[model samples]
Target: MMISVLVSPAPPEGIAPTFGWGTFAAWDSDLYRNIVINGYSYDFSRNEYLVAFFPLLPLLIKAVMFLGLPFEIAGFLINNLAFLGAVLLVYNWVKELYSIKAARWATAVLVWCPYSLFGTVIYTEGLFLLFSTAALRAFQKKQHFWAAIWGALATATRLPGLAIMFTFLIVSWREKRSLIAYIASLCSGGGLFLYSLYCGMKFGEPLAFLKAQKAWQPAQDFWGQDWLKMFMQVLVGSRNWKAGKIVDPLHIIIVLLICLGAYLLWRSHLKLGQNKTQFGYCILAIILWLLAGSPLINTVTILGGVYLIWHFRAQLNLLATYGFCSFGIIFSSGRATSAERYTYAIISVSIALGLLLEQYPRWGYPVLILFGFLLASLAVRFSQQLWAG
Candidate 1:
């Protein structure tokens, strides 16, 4: 956090002031703080972007301020504290899956991830991690009801969270083969359902959040014909470096690499005695990529998800259901612009990478060092209001 502040120069023109808040609160942090202080407005003439941000963290910030702490302090503390809790839950959860050594590696990788800086800031990553990890832990313990409750909170934290419900359904079916599991799984989306109701009351449109998303940027659906046309153009080289919004050479490469990684990782897992389901997960991921237009963010996150499914192949149904569904929810919308941040919600990426490193200690040290270097570099850029993600 201190390095982030020191490396960042003074705020540029038109940028929101930190107002004595820490530099960590820059970028999307300001949007959250604004919502905390001013509350939501339906007036598009004002802050229409607020509708896109979920209410959990900002509301927590406001609640904490009642204890005489300022929003900055409250926001920062909440994020860090929630992250600490998440770390603990993740440690125990991974340990339950394998050994304590693997658990430690998983926790370390999560903490040292290039994107972990956002978890330490006033962003929703920390809180989302807290809820999502709790949900996973509860589900692993076979506490289906509690899992649904925690999963519902996770959904409230982020839209991708609804994907977790699929995992719950799988678990329930495998454990009891009952319809109650399906019914209970629906509870996972209760938060989004409630939010839609709130939007209906406040904006006269239950899907106002979807509409407000346009105010931020132009986003396309992954299933749209345009994405397929653009993908083909990028592949055929008919589209140059800067052709259509959809066909950036860099992002196209990212998509290709993601596909290659998933395939290679699937084969490696099978060679290691992992099940066919691992390969099935990879195939499912590819199908989603084909349909979703495979944005850079989605591509990277899906690659991570494929690796995770392979790593947790023993629990293939459990992790695969959650991983694929989460990717599906994000790609279902078609724009992968914020995927760097959105990918954080996947959580399995960090764990899977950590597990991979643990199995290959010779490669682990260098990878971690590289991760730290990129993390610090990105932190500096993000603090300076430069786009890193």
Candidate 2:
């Protein structure tokens, strides 16, 4: 069950884990390098100060290291805990408004996700998902302040946190709870802004991380690159600093399953018509995801199975939208093969899955298995990276 298995015996060849997975593995060396040397936390020093990875994830990892747990154990504890939180929130949110079946399926899809495993490996997605869902749940209950505050915390975990702000405003206006909603929205929106300011001071320039990213990889407008290139990266593998050897094309198979999901979404949307408020939540969540870009797309695109089974069924296409967006991202990816390259591979799998859904319909699953093999090949690639750590 533990993804950190490699760290135990002999980490394979070139693998380089931060802190050697000793007491500091969870505290990514890169993350702590920024924090410990200087009191200034966040990435104003290196890149886009406004919209890079959040500080909460780094801070959390540090806390684990500080607790004296080995980095692997610390990372495992934090990430799995975050995963549990994500699962709990999704279940409760679905159960609160819709049927138990919806909640159960949502949680299952999320928990079983191959991609979600990344979160369980000291990644940020699970923490972000947990906060995002909690924010949404709060909004649904008309708990404006709580929703905004939680949503803000979620945003601190990932850039898509803004979706909470957008949805809260929309729902508040719809329900005529304008004042409370406005207040909550401000609080939620302020969370990231405040963090950004702190990061700016630490880095010498505000939004330093933002500036650095532009310099690192300048993306043209309409950045999503061609679909084929995305496939090659996955089929072969991508070489990125962030994710190391990430050629996992397994998600391509998941994307293939969206066909039935889209049909279900259309039918369900038509069937539910105007009465489905939960669908609105999905819409808002999707919108937030689109804006967050990289991490969000990575999280959303590999969800072929889950989307196929969404309870509101009609909202299924909402799940499919990530594929289209991923097309745009592949375009943005440049000649340099970085973590973004593997990301393109993901984007490639996404939109391709959308096409397969429309065309083969029944043939989707087996094809996914094939693509998954391609992704699996990358496993060998990273053994070096992990061991070297």
Candidate 3:
């Protein structure tokens, strides 16, 4: 439905070739008339730095562009296919663990979510989420090899994906089957190693993403003399940092309602005491993911794990709350350019994890949602203040 909607609205014009990088290789290339064959890093026009983005997403976009489909159409088609995969996995997941209503609501929320359109930006979110969830669903059934294969694909799509095999760690430990999970995780985790090695050989460091972030100045100035002062300000009373302001009070209200819905989902989960461990893994994964990487990388691993909180009987804990705050701090303290938008992930993931802590109870769900929205409410206000120019 999404693809067709955008397809008629936008169709491809002609053919193109993009064999290499440094020529606006990422999503920007999706908008180009042709994908030029250029080198990966060097010889880039000053304005072509958009190629700094990862490779897989653009290549997918290029293939779609090759189908004579417009860029927007291609993006929609890929995201639509991803949506289908996400839906199938989520539906099967909920059906297996909960009720038919849960399945319906879960799929409905994701499919109808406007914010999720961000995933359709010739990016990896849709594909990553779909594959990761499907892998988890496979694991739930004890299909080890299939789970490993999916994890490998998932890792290929999302950089943090290599960590997802940790699920197998728990499974293996509990079931006394280490060798298989080890083999699977190793095979899937190898790319992360290879990528690092290749990057080290090329750039004299194993952490290419980190190098890229530093090279591109995506974070604070590594050499700024005011680092101490800036860090203090960001942690306490921030002045230089930026956030957003929602112009629509009604949208604010709607976001509040969504928060309420998410709260209800959490409350529903906490009712099962024995299921707390499972809940722990899902929410703990989110917290850890948030703490371990950059904003984009954190979002994928967090979302992949959070997609499986179907039991609706989670146990709320204070430690989880603290972890969320710490994660938010790091995100908000980043560089000022579009830095505020990071709050969306911080708030959403935290709330999603918090919901896993307990069933916020039906009576309190709406009020808690209001509070969550209110807390996140400042995010919009901050964004406007930052981008006021």
Per-candidate Cα RMSD to the true structure, in Å, reads: 7.4, 11.6, 12.3
Cα-based lDDT for every prediction: 0.71, 0.49, 0.45
Candidate with maximal lDDT = 1
Candidate 1 achieves a global lDDT of: 0.71
**Tens digit per residue, CA lDDT, model 1, 39-141:** 7666667646677877778878999999999877899899999999999988888888877888888888888877788888788889888888788777777
Instruction: Mark the regions of model 3 whose C-alpha exceeds 4 Å error after superposition.
Output: 1-39, 42-52, 112-114, 197-206, 221-389
Q: What is the Cα-based lDDT of residue 342 in candidate 3?
A: 28
For candidate 1, give the lDDT of residue 321.
Answer: 66
Quality of model 3 by C-alpha lDDT: 0.45
lDDT of 3 by residue, 1-389 (tens): 22223222222431232222211123333423233224244222343333234444555766877878765556656755885777676666665665565455455444433234434444455776676666655665667688777766665554545445655555556567768666775665554565566656865656654445445654455433233433333232222222323333443343345456556556766575535534544454344323332332323433332342322214212212322432344343344332322222222232333334334333233334433443333322222221110
Worst 10-residue lDDT window for candidate 2 reads: 341-350
For candidate 2, write residues 246-329 as lDDT tens digits. 445443333333334545666787667744634553554444433332343333443332343232234433222332333333
Per-model TM against the reference: 0.77, 0.58, 0.52
Off by over 4 Å in 1: 7-20, 43-47, 177-180, 219-240, 243-302
